[model samples]
Target: MNFYNIVRVSVVAALLGTSCLPAAAVSPPPARTSAVTNEDERLLALFRDDQRREQAIDPLGMLYRTGKSDPALLRQVFTDNPVRALNKSVKLSLSALKKIDRAKLSPERQISYDVFLYDKTEEAFWLRPDMLALTQVTPLDHFGGLHIQFPSLMAKGSAVSYDNVADYEDALAVDRAFPFVLDNAVVRFRQGLDSGVVTSRLTTANMIAQIDGLLAQPIEDSPFYSPVRDFPDTVPMSERTRLQKAYFAAIRDEIYPAYRRLRAFLNDEYLPAAREQVGILGMKGGPGLYRHLIEQQTTLPLEPEAIYQLGLSEVARIQREMDVVRKEMGYGEGDLRSFFDTMRSDPKFHPKTKEELANGFSAVGHRVDELVPLFFNHVPRTKLLIQPYPAYREKYEAGGSYNQGAPDGSRPGIFFYNTYDLPSRFLTGIDTLYLHEGAPGHHFQISLAQENTALPDFQRFGGNNAYVEGWALYAETLGYEMGFYKDPMQHWGTLDDEMLRAMRLVVDTGIHFKGWTRDQAIDYMLSNSGMGRSDATAEVERYIAWPGQALGYKIGALTIQRLRKKAETELGPKFDIRAFHDQVLMSGALPLPILEAKIDRWIASQKG
Candidate 1:
């Protein structure tokens, strides 16, 4: 999953009751000339201007991407207010984009034009007043809520700089804004309460637990205080004392107090008012909102019922494959549930310690790196680190997640493995998980995009759930050709992971659209796969917190898989897997339709 997306995914999504915008032409355009060159330059210049203006308003976002933020802009905290500015920016950009004739540009420029238009038009829809009503009121959740991301952003391993005295003070300036962000969230929660559109009770409880964990940490151990605990050699000795004091003051006076206020509000006011039903379908504008999120997240015009049905079909097919794998593992003619039971109950399938888990993942990464050249022509130079989730955040996190590194390769991209409840975590999915979240998955897809200076900023940094997560899920299939899944247990692990994604399609749509209860979702996951109760519960809660997101993994992987099959069939033996991967990834993430178009164009070119 994209690190930056988690915090904002709950608050923003596609506009309800709207069809997708018509795509820009993807076929080869006329030959380039002085006129076309001028248009391309003008169009690119407009994109750059929009990015700069956006960065000006969102200094933290700018800092995350570029590792630099203006001191004057550091005080601007992230909030819902930017949606309005983004709406206006999209309108102006689209107007300017329409004036350029897409057919006059070269094919390369045409792809950029299509992606840019799709992105802005999609934003225009979501930023509408009606759409914002469904999102803005319910601001945070346990999964990707700002409460979780803020600390993670401030932690040592994250992407920002802490090189000198000025850097320390710039962080302080940003740290001061935490309280206001929390206050604004409370205001939004109150709005949700007034309108009877609050978050789910389960999610509210999860957020409360998460906040309580944060508040329980001592002042010195707080992630916000981490920066000053260890001073760099560049800082003068006299300044170190003051910096340490200021950092502690920020955490004590500003940060912890804000967290306590949020905790109290959630415990006292919001939790009671929060809905008992986990699904959004029970809320006032829920049905429309779920539809909007489904479209927004998957980048497809799929009805929830359609997704639910597709999920059912996928689950049955995967279970059949699981049955075959079960027989291969020396279990004779037993039901799939029995095999699942053994996998879950057998202590041998789990990690002995967190270090053991970390070592296992590191080994997988090393092996994958050795074979990287066999499939991918482009390998990211950005370092990938494997570490367990920090104590404060692990209980609520997923099995694993990837944080992007600096484009300049200063900080390494990290894949956080959840070692919470160590005995409950399985060793079965270790290699597949490593492939999905580490090398050639998020690390590859994200690092490659950002490292390529030749692409436009949007193509390099901007992304959608369908392409980003889908590419990662697709990356998991690469394990087969690489021979990682040769062991029957390992293959079962891959199937189990695949089953989780397939079940997400059913369960996510089931909860939000069909009103499946939280327990109901958990029971379904446990019955279908070897997932333990703890992992199953966490996955269900995640879907409850962020509906329609899990749907993208299976849907996206299927799309990429289908496109690859089409390319292979058409190109015959001439097809190069490396080139196919390059075509899919070289332009960064694209909407599924745009990606399909690009692949079709590549297929045609190869045929000639």
Candidate 2:
């Protein structure tokens, strides 16, 4: 999943909303009429109702998705009560969805019905009382926490537009609401502390540091103040001074204090109580939560051990491929460890300046654009922008991430490459990174779905990580077909990335299920790949903060790869790579089972 999309547990909880449902309580569809009773129309209406309810509960999210400012929505702060309401709404929607006879619906609506069921089921699982207790209580983390995401969300050209006077007012409302969200987080954390379901000490420390970083910034210099600094022509000149004062005051009085309060709480109380064991296995009811996360994330009933074993096997296989790349580079004599050392130390493999780093990614993107038609039949109409992460966010941010643009082409998709600790970052992986996070990866997958208005909003906007991240990981492999990995170092870079996903399978399970330490997980990552220490540490901690999420990349990619191989074998000369991709992507992100079934149907159609 893209970094920004992986929001805080609270953000997700708010997105899920207040509701209740028994597990597996969806009723079967009502009896159908042979004459066609307009079930598709009824289903479409239900989808529209669901979207309305979602906007009511998750206005901020809708603002991001649509790029339309709603002052009413922007004025509201996130609260747990809304999450409960959202749950009830989702349950009602699910029940209503099941009441429609699928047989009477059009084939297109049938696909929508299946995807809706899958999405609601997952939503219900996360919103369940027990599940919420385990997840929603410890909402903030160093990765994907509100403190980090809020700044990025409020930045210029982000989801929300800052174009007019009312737009600036909407931002002020949002700015004022942030403290309430932070306050709510404090309440949740305290509840977790009471219940003994607190975050890990490592995660807590990282979060405190993040909060401290935010607190240290001057009021006007804050990201929240960024909007005030740049008034557009549309924003009336008369309103500028007022908006600027309002923004600065909000940041100084509301935002900074909230950060400081949270920081103090973490350092004084939560830190002492935080668990040393970083894995979910150590917390109250953690193992069950981990198991649930595995199933939820991969959209399959996979055991941790099974995933771990798969990861191990994948790691070994990729290593062999790495050896081939090494040998081809005339490094037949030395061990991979030594070669990794050379790659790490070699100045040629690292960018000297941030500009050069940004240029490198832009070059990779342009090269992919030139070759995209050979592999993809569809490219998103929305433009893609490549730039380095802003300083405030770059510190703890992932190496690279893609934030999708507005569907109507109002905003361009952005691929933010990290320029932090530039020397530690590798240039070898630039091609693979661009392919995964930028073109034909997230930018393609997310933008295509958003732009396709024919699909229901849930199908267009909602997605499972297995298909989303899995498709991105699979996109990385196309580098080879496009000849981007001909250089042995570049080939190794792709393999190293593949190894990162494979190791996630093992290390994630090993930490949570097999009782691996944070250090052990980090060491395993460092030793197995050419990833720098900083990146390895951040990656491991991310898994700790969010269990079972990383599993999606390799697991999802493997499913897609296996299906593609099956399609190639079955269709022979009839197989069209572009068409197959369209089949996989055009439906939006699907659960693995649904995606596999869809591909199988496509293959049968090809055969006929």
Candidate 3:
């Protein structure tokens, strides 16, 4: 998933609440003729242009801070007013979609549409006002805050100031637009289900239960309450405290209760009804849908068995490397599984305190920045910050995560370290994690994408999972070539991480497609890699929660590796890795096929 969708996916199941804005007095319209004067036209034109620009960029900021499940608010912003000119733009988009040949569209775009079309309930849930408020509202003013340009336009239409109206209207518009998108999505979803491409009835039932639970919550008890308030983090000290109290009140009253309802529903109404059978093969046209997902994700037209086999080969290759590391660590004849246990239990690897863990991550961030110049000439102007994960989310966050800043530079890219379990936090692979999630990995690629004004909004601030995750994985290896992994243990940590991802290719498919139990997947990871039990358990649950996502890292990394090797061989001695990297970053993120096409063009130009 791209960054925008990531926020939507994460938050769709959560409850949120917002205070009602004071009603605005009706405003007199500016003098108008059948045709507006040039100056008036210019003003409206400028406003419309600004609105579209903000709309495009808004999703990026929204995804980072909140999840993306709200479509109702999106529809309102794009199409709420019957007389609004922006509604014309929505019509224009529909027209464009109709005019284009579905088959002729790029595979990535097609998959995007197909996914959207098949999942009406999800589309509706994503566009809901609460969902939009949860995902889009933030402390940053320019992007989600009141001072932003689009807010100014909305305020002009209403009597409220830009700041007050922006949040409410943006939220309202998204809620309105959500159902329309879901209507289209349901059509596609049924087709996929019938065809046997997406046969996970259990997953669907769980998702539905989650949504039902969210809907049951009272708005006052939502986790999203703080974010939806007028000045999320900037209320006067007294007001801030009030807001915080209200936020928790809402979480307890609305959000948690909703989650419990859904959880109970899943257990009572859905789980038992789920099927025991696996794979898309039983669906009428299952092979085709599976083909489409593979094509969309890998950007290749390989069959499921071929993709599965490719995963198997990669797993074997990474295990061999892990064995080499094991022997070097002097664990002769000790199976890889035992080594993983030793690494997990070793007190020497654990952090003494949360502060120490945060500082250790900060140090890794600095070290990565130092080596960045060695590998590439072009570097992002964006700043990076290493912070502990917010207290509310530390328990569930990945080991480390990168939240990219706004395209307009309102926020700095943040690398949030999860320090909930200190024993699980260690020096074992901190450097690799930093490189993968922070400097020269997500931060670099994402910031550069936001900085590129030349690319379309979708190409610039948006991305494919394969490209985003793949590039991050590739960044990990660069640490070695740039001389940052001087310590043998650190180097081994990098390989261990890589091995973990490769193993995912096997385990993800194993669980969802092959019916392997959760324990079996955890056991496989324990036997193959030196990860802590808590960490391994978390990773396994993540795959269970999100199928197919684990495959993206290995698939993406290997694709880039193949591309780099091809570039080196084709360019011979003249090939400069720095220049090649610049070319890659300059285009921002694209579908792998598009990236490959661009690289081929770059190579051809260099030859001439």
Candidate 4:
């Protein structure tokens, strides 16, 4: 759900045995595109300028966001005033866009125009008084904030380059900037407090836990210190010593102190004020905020009550399927609650060691690779790497999430499997988990977009959650076709994952709209699904921290699935699986409505 944990190191190191250039350089540059028309050229120039600002605000985004087009960009750190600059950028982009006459432009330019205008408009919507009053004050959550993500970015062997003296120097600048990011975050939290907009007490505690973990570590062991742990041998010894000393100073003095202060701010100031209630509606502008988020995330006009009803239906439907999984085993099979308890407590269902759990993910990836040809022809050039979630991040994160690689296949796509709480982690779901997060899911969808230079940068890099997570959720169903769910146990896993998303719709809406308390939300999820208490609690907290986001997966997936059904019915014999997949993925991510329109157009064409 947190898109920040993505953008991995390039693939050159793993694939070729040695580095030819910095990983960024290995990714093929964005195709040399000239304007199709004078208007398009002008618009593209504007888009390019916008892209640079996009690159500036997001340091991790530079690779995929700009296709690593500017090496000088790599040398510069993240912008000083990101939130402010983003607001200004939206205003400027919108203003510039208004001067361009859409009627006069080529059809291609019109498409670009529509997408940008919609995107900028969506961004500007957040700047409205009701939205800003609710959102801008709470800059960081246990989930969506920079605090959890920044450490991972600067971690060794992650996205941030630590290959050379210049890389280290540039990274140091980014490292130094952390204090500002943290301090500004504090100011925002203070603003939220003043405006009667604060996050849940649970979220505040989790954030404090993360900060405390960081502070307790020695500077050398800190994730921030990871880059300097072992510098490239190419650097001079004297330089290495100096860099090491400087890194220690940066971590110990700058980074550590910032986290300490941030922790203090949360414990001493923020937590006492953090609302005991977990819903967005519990805040000053509750109803408006929840509505905006639903529209923004689901890319639909559906209301919370509607989504809540949809979730209940989905939960029931998934439960019936799970029932079949239970019946397939053919036993005394107690009531649904007891069945869920049986699944949870069964020793054979959970992995013993953390290594076994990780290996289970790899095995799933390998099995999925064998079945790919049955689904479609094209596959991502990127190899999928299965790794455990970094210890610091696992507590706050979901069971598994994917990080995309460079479009040119310079980086391997990483699937961070949560190996924390090994005993609580279920083995039955590992196959479905890998199928969703690894090769055929995010790896294929995200990589194919980035790899395709034929599309514009915005479509390639930009995404709507409904399309993005919808596609991933849709990917989970492919296991049914791939012969994975043939194993009754693995089949149960897929259903379990589906139930989690389905429950999210019910629970998320319940928390924010139906006035469900955090405990009540957690209980609802646990009562309905085979999810462990820790997993359920983390999930409930996630919905609380990032409301409406969890809906994207189920809402998007269902839409895509419905479109596919419509296509299959309309096209009849002409519904080529490969073509259908290409149509879905080729244009990259789209808003659900745009995606439906495009798919319908494709279906109509195929009908002939």
Count residue pairs with overlapping backbones in model 1. Answer: 0
Model 3 agreement with the true structure over 401-448: per-residue lDDT tens digits: 776665655557777777878887657688888888887888888888
CA shift of 376, model 4, Å = 3.0
Q: Write down the TM-score for model 2.
A: 0.94
lDDT of model 1, residue 118: 87
Ranking of predictions according to lDDT: 1, 2, 4, 3
Task: Compute the lDDT for candidate 4.
Answer: 0.74
- Per-residue lDDT of 148-183 in model 1, one digit per residue for the tens? 777777665574578899888877777777677677
| Residue pairs that clash (backbone atoms under 3 angstroms), model 4 | 10-410, 10-411, 11-410, 11-411
Off by over 4 Å in 3: 1-264, 275-291, 330-333
Best by lDDT: 1
Which residue pairs clash in candidate 1? none
Give candidate 1 regions above 4 Å deviation: 3-36, 68-81
